[model samples]
Target: MCGIGGIWNRDQKTVDRSLLQSFTQVIAHRGPDDSGYYFDDDCGLGLGHRRLSIIDLSSAGHQPMASGDQKYWLVYNGEIYNYLELTAELVALGYQFRSHSDTEMILAAYQAWGYDCLNRFNGMFAFLLWDSSKQLLWAARDRFGVKPLYIWEQSPNFIAFASEIKQFTKLPNWKAQVNPQRCYDFLAYGMLDHTSETMFKDVWQLRGGQYLTLNSDRQDADFGKLTVKQWYSLPSNQQDLSMPEAKQQLQNLLKDSVKLRLRADVTVGSCLSGGLDSTSIVCLSDQLRQESANNIPFQTFSSCFDDLRYDERQYIKDVIAQTQVHPNFIFPNANELFEELDHLTWQQDEPFGSTSIFAQWCVFRQAGQSGVKVMLDGQGADELLAGYTKFYAALFANLFRKWHWGKLVNELITCRRYQNATEIQRMIEPLLPIWVRQPLRRLLGYASETAVPSWLNGSYLQTLGVTPQVSAKFALTTPTSIHQLSHLQITSTSVPMLLHWEDRNSMAHSVESRVPFLDYRLVEFAYSLDDTTKIRQGQTKAVLREAMRNIIPESIRTRQDKMGFVTPESQWIKHGLSDRFEIELQKAIASLGQWVQPDVLQKIFQATLDGNSGMQGVIWRVISFSRWLKVFDVKI
Candidate 1:
């Protein structure tokens, strides 16, 4: 629950304390409670931290905390929900602690178990440990990507790391240079091709489940010498799954996950949207808390909008009634969001063009004001449980291509899937070759087929430097699921944008948000489960609903809609921003040399203003890239 920043100068030069201080200060919103720094002038290493006290509110919680023997110092962000448990295990192993702080637990754990400490804990986290004895640095991101970490390295004397990329702007030479291919990927797929790359050319996000180590003596920063190891990833099963067994396993894991996430010293609540994921989270979390005799009546939070077409407060009300959990509703206005946009984008360290992000932000703000320090959310459930309609759509595509029309239609009916919206038709009508519906489809596939043979194709290594497994996953649609479920990995343009919004919006209020369903184990298991478990007999999220049968409101449990924290964005753009959209769009076109095609953007703006928020995806990508270029000063 903090922002961390630091520098390691291989040359043993003193790091400018003011610079590190300045970098971290920019993210003070992330950790307003306290700030700390650690430096070893002789070792050319330094670490700085901004704290948002949660677990241990004592002075013992002060960070840049050191191991008992003082061999290592840690500047950590995020909570180790199992710290008390890990602490007991360490004490049994003869470890001594001076504080109840998880930071101390983290430092001690690293000292005792080395990098293996990651496997023994459960929580959202991103941390860096400076091993004074070895002059090496170790950092790890959480298993579920709930917390974010960024890294930058060049053949140089310095390698910088931080919880947010804006801290890197403190670098003397850092620039906002845009990566063209990133724009292409963002436009085509909504994210830069892989996890490691960002919109910026030099900075990279530490892919979740990966850790990195840098040695002071490595002249080139020796990326080869820098280990990027994954402690967690979805497991693979060569065979399909049994629905009954799958349901039981999902139920057990989910309950355990909710219980673990609820471990907090502060008030804990759940984010309940109209969607199955969040609703289920509220039900199970409230049930688990109540059964544990914790007597902690949890609070439920939901976002509100003037547009009831997209608002689902009724659904939230339904669940609250069932659980007796008091509900909090926050209404966000586009006008207020207009003012917060720049600061919000700065916190995210990139331009986020999604308006719905504002809705999530309002919820987080309300949580902060309600005096809640930690909130449980169903962030990863969609990815893990085949909860999105896009998954159904992709499954439909794969089945029809394999000529399994009966199976496709049956699953479609069971999932309550729909088809051919006017907007979708416009994009695909001409692009989808008429012959593709039949035997001629094979030829049509060749057009969108990537031109370069990826590492997955078993060729010479690629210039992109993406790993073979990563390249293969990119080549396949997405989700890295089994053959029958592979197509479900496809992320609509709005999905990635929404996730970015989620992270930035939540962190903006100094509130720690946790997502259990995204855990690699759960994700892999969900995908490996038989598709029937996810969508059965005209019900989406069937297995999840059954697991929470008596916990969630029966009305909501029976609801078929899967809309997430949706915002009535189109109407807002039309009534609140019509002039700004056109003026800015035209200006964007005028600077085509420094920007992307204005015409492409104008149409997206018009469509959205004309009351089609779904089209906001393409426009969101373009606008994000445009703003990123202007902010970063990328010439291309």
Candidate 2:
């Protein structure tokens, strides 16, 4: 809901007012309504904030706010959906407030419970709190990292934190330098934001469920030490529950999450992709609106395409017929996407996987143009509920490993009847030993996990000691259960990258995007359910369908095809944008230098253009990385 930045100069140099302002101003698109600043000359610390004014739009909501005793100064960049509830509790404890804002609630809570206050919060947030009396600085991100916090340490004594990495460019002595390992990871494995280390060298992010603290009053040896620690983590234990019990609990949790996210001063809407995750939110939100008698004319936004192969207009219409909602749609064309490629790349602050991100960018843009400030989206459901088809492989592996032939056979039949089941090869691939599978993949001309891509410069990667493989943090060699795979995806692989896209795309237009499904209570409960409850009769998110049986239209509740904000990347490469693709490909090969092989990449692009290959993802990476390098003037 806002942009926040700060400077902690441990050497005790007076913080420059203009430099702090520059850091906050660079990301003004995130918060354009108001700005605030605070300086502590004695501690050599300063905080800057750009306010979007979601919860309380009055001047009282202005940030860089101070506690009643003026002991703590806070600059925050997200919403605490439960702030109203927290305020009531704090008031009961005799705490007074000057502003009707969540910012004040946080200060009062911290004054009462200290760091333990984070355990009581249930929302998406990233904030910096300066304890002026103690000469201490505290920073923390939300449980699921729905908000972003980047840290740049020039040295142990001087550190800067911001909501976006672009703010670091405002530092006087800073230069943009590419991190080769991250570049290789994106080009070869399509990974971004998978770890704390970002694509820029020396720039790190505070991971989700984590916090950091710095004290200036310590001994010389520990003076500049920044202690980072985990504040929350997913529950490792699963709960045993009947199917009926699990469905009711999930429905209740989701409904409450949606209700909490709807607590905003500005206009709020939902992102409808016609898929189960998004449709469920829209339908539930409408249901809530009618029950509460809040007639603000609930609206929904979606991205559509003329190409039916890549469109979900039919399903979108189905939902509209069921709910009393006003629907808006945007048709994102390849020409428009290319026209704004540089801007979108700069907004993202790094290269992304595919044009699907452009589709999302268009959705947020449309929402902003329509005067919607906060939009609820469905992002975490897929990871938590095993919505991806690839999860089917993990389900089969779990059953086969346990030697449950009866269940395995029944699942295969159900899957074939209800789902595509075209990934049967992948479903059975996990059963093969690694030694045998590696050789078989090689025989099929497929690259193994350790094998470097032909288009990448193997020698350059070797010199940098960069192995072109998936991050071990996300790699599950052999997942024994859907829960294990869900844990990995939620923690490292999918949710982080998706959240990155969600934040940037929405904030680029000053829109606040919320993910109700990522509420800690809902995420924990979803993960605790049995795999059968998630994927039953071969349908993904089966429990969600049953929970919304009458709440949503039957057509949508039983829908199977999974396409959330999908774009026609392959079709564009072959038809509408072939010339542009070739031009960008050549520019990338020339500008990328030793990091890529020109001939190999050219052949790959040509193969895709000729409809002989399905390497659209690789092609887009090349185009995106090239533009990112130019947009930020990154030094290779």
Candidate 3:
């Protein structure tokens, strides 16, 4: 994977070649191997690329690559795992290639099939193609949003796009203005969005599953003038199939997805958290390699902790005992987190929700140091397959809504025995009226608290303004059924947030992270299955358990407790980080007084100091936001 940046002058002014070079240099870490540039004076468009050189090491693979006869130019980030198949198909249709690179295959496919080539691609990507022949700019991102693409418009006529928002800072007129509404949403509701709006004013993230087309000939264009379209969407049509048939279909899809992601010229490894999602990736990868007579030990990276409650070493050991692959472990501590706090915040480019993201950052850093270029991960499984405890509520809600009382009771008992859960409140939740239950859920933090936090300055809150509903888009609207919930997780909520963190963390270390579970075919197959298939017998990801029954050790396969990438944040706040955290908290209050209430902030800090562990997360977010402000020198 690599970083892409470019500028298009809609007013047909001469493009600044130096500006492209400056912005592209800012994200050099994303692609350090080589850099390329292409500028067309006639169209006033410039394209720049930073290459990581994964597939083919030869110069033939270099990009801003032009097609023969110079009709098209392309800059791309990400791998096309199915390039070989597409290449073969294209050649049979009279297409020719110069290099054994996925980039070339993409160009050939586009040439042969035009925009229709997007539907045929089976990998993560954010690409921009300059069709000089058509005098149009075509841009697209991968279906699952595994890759990032940001767009900024200087005016209706001039546009700039990049792989990261930081690249935009190099523009001569670039201003770092804070988006107050986004800040309010983030602080009040913890609403991290996957929508078009970004934290920075005038800069926007292109939603995943969407593409852009802009005409070179259009004069004095505007944001609305760009023809943006959603080409991909999660499949909602349920197929008529038995559980057995669905399981077989899902098994085949996953196997093929894993095999395709294994396509790389450089060394590949995987992140193993000892949870079902990651363990399945590691074990399945090893099994597939063995089947292909490639017996090289697959490298697995994990973060372990001294706190047994937060550690998954036992489950990790179980997977190791069964597969016996090469393993690498990291003991991430509060010290490392504190030391890298500012750097991590800068890398993320935004305030992240939790410290669990640091554990993932450490995993990617270790992978880079170990000389692994591409790391396969299990990021999208939980969202696609209802693999969280929260999904249990959705399941019970469905049963109660359907008047399946006997089934609900039987499942509750089975869950109590299997998961050792005593939360009877969940089983009784569906019986309450929507009005009464909704407020109760919000009070318990089961729903996002849209009410302004007690810590916000009243003046600032009033200045930020209020609406009857400012959070409808960011709110995780409760789904009607377990299937619909899983679908929303992929389309709107958890998976998108998780993917954003994974991409930023991995790319910070210059490593490409591939997620097999996010393969559209696999996602479609999983979502098509009945909710009972996913959470069978009170086990989340139950179908996955059945598919990997003999492959993964029974101990890990049947694990009911899942603590994926958890950390000792509360402990750190109370002990190891008390002094520094207090200092940072005070600094944050002073720096953000206009937006934050100093008295309320002090009270929150005092609560954390008084051994209220839950209050530590609030302190962390304040510290993160403050650091981000200083790092970016942001303006309100």
Candidate 4:
């Protein structure tokens, strides 16, 4: 809902007001209504904020908001949905508020509870707080990583942070360089889910569910010295709940979560795709609409690809028939929007190769033109619940590796995920850990960053010298490092793609979008479910589908494929983008020096042209990285 940026100087110089101004100006689309700044010379802290004003549309909500005694000043991005409840609790504990803004409530809550306040917050957020009384600076992102926070910490005096990576460019002496290791991760898997390491050398993304406490003094601000801690983590399975119980609980949680997010002074709408998640959200939202009897009803926007096989128009029609919500279509033709590519690339702080991002961008653009300020989306359901087919495949493989072919084949045939039980059993043989597979289910996850490909045997993402532990850290659902999860095929590329796309395109037209499915509590609740229920009985999200049995259509709710948001990159590479592919590859090779093997690169490009899907992964990585460099002036 906002863009937060600031700098901390150790040796207190006359603060460069323009630097702060530039930081705020670049991300104006994030918070277009107003801007605020807070500076403390003694503490060497300067905070800049651009407010989108979703919660409270009043001047009282204007931020760089300070506490009652002006002892703490804060700039935050995201909504604290439980602000009212927290406010009542805070007031009970002698904390007072003058503004009816969530921002003000955050300042008061932090003052009363300090860092403990984060545990009580239930919404998405990334914020920086300067404790005037204590001279301490704190920055924390949400538990689910709904919002983004980027930081630059080369030296203490140069410690800076921003809501978007582009805001970092506003700093006085910023330079752009690719962290080679990050590029390697991108090539390995379309995301870099590690800590602070971005495509830009010094600029780093703050991992979700993590916080930073740093000193302003350059000499004292050693990363080695600061101890960053995570307030929350996703435990594999701490609860011993049954699948039926989980399905019912998930349904209730999702409904209530949607109910809370339905709160808006302006009109509410939703992003609907042919998939079960989006359709389920739309169905539930429509039911809420019917109960409210507001007569306003809800609106639905869906994206359409040129390929009929991938298009979900029939599914959208099914939902529309039942709910009768006014549905709009945002069609994306790769050939047509190639011109918009440069601008769309710029919206993302780092480079993103997925053309599906542009498709999401088109959805928000339509949302803005339709006069809707907020929209709900089903973004994180896959990661939280076991929606991807790959999980089961991995599980089956893991079992087979332990000579449990009987159990593995039974699962494969029941899940109906693969053909020929013996073939699948053979395929899964090498996947087991040296240890037992029945208990641990050691398998090659479809999202495994450490799993090297045939062509990727010596790929840079592996040899570029980052630890597989680091790679694994990024791939985790919980927060340790931000990069891994951010780029998790589910979270990194898909979730962030929708978020950044919605944020920019909606803001471009002065509309604000909200996603309830992405609520941290919902995310936590989903991740907490048993993996067995997620991909059970030859069904992905087995519990999730059952939960919505009465709501979403049987066809959509029972969908077997886990195609969330994707484009035909292979088709584009060969026919549509042939010329652009040639030019971009040449540029990437020439401009990026020797980061990738040119022989391998040409082979990859030719493979795409020849209909081989093997190189699609690395080609997209190189192309996305190359395009990012060309646009952002970033270099290796």
Which model scores highest in TM-score? Answer: 2
Better of 3 and 4 by lDDT: 3
Q: List the candidates' TM-scores in order.
A: 0.86, 0.98, 0.95, 0.87
**Model 2 poorest 10 in a row by lDDT:** 469-478
Tens digits of lDDT, candidate 1, 192-246: 4255677778888777678988765434445225667878654556336576666
102-194: candidate 3 lDDT, tens digit per residue: 898888888988999999999999999998877788999999788989999988777899998888888878888888777666665555655
Candidate 2's residue-wise lDDT over 1-636, tens digit each?
Answer: 999999988876589999999989999999999999999888789999999989879999898999978899999999999999999999999999888899999999999999999999999899999987777899999998999999999988889999999999999779999888877878777888888999999999999999998886544456677999999999987898888899999999999999999999889998999999899999999999999999898889999999999889898999999889999998997898879999999999999999999999999999999999999999999999989877888888888888988988888888886565446666666678889887776665455757787888898878977865554334426477899989888888889999999999999999999999999999999999888898887888888888888988788888887889899899999998889888888898888999888888888888898888888788899889989999999998
The window of 10 residues in a row where model 1 has the poorest summed lDDT is 452-461
- Which stretch of 10 consecutive residues in model 4 shows the poorest summed lDDT? 477-486
- What ranges in model 4 sit over 4 Å off? 216-227, 397-407, 417-513
Q: At residue 49, give the lDDT of candidate 2.
A: 97
RMSD of each: 5.6, 1.4, 2.3, 4.9
Candidate 4: Cα lDDT at 538: 69
Best lDDT among the predictions, by candidate number: 2
- Score each candidate by Cα lDDT: 0.68, 0.89, 0.82, 0.71
Better of 1 and 4 by TM-score: 4
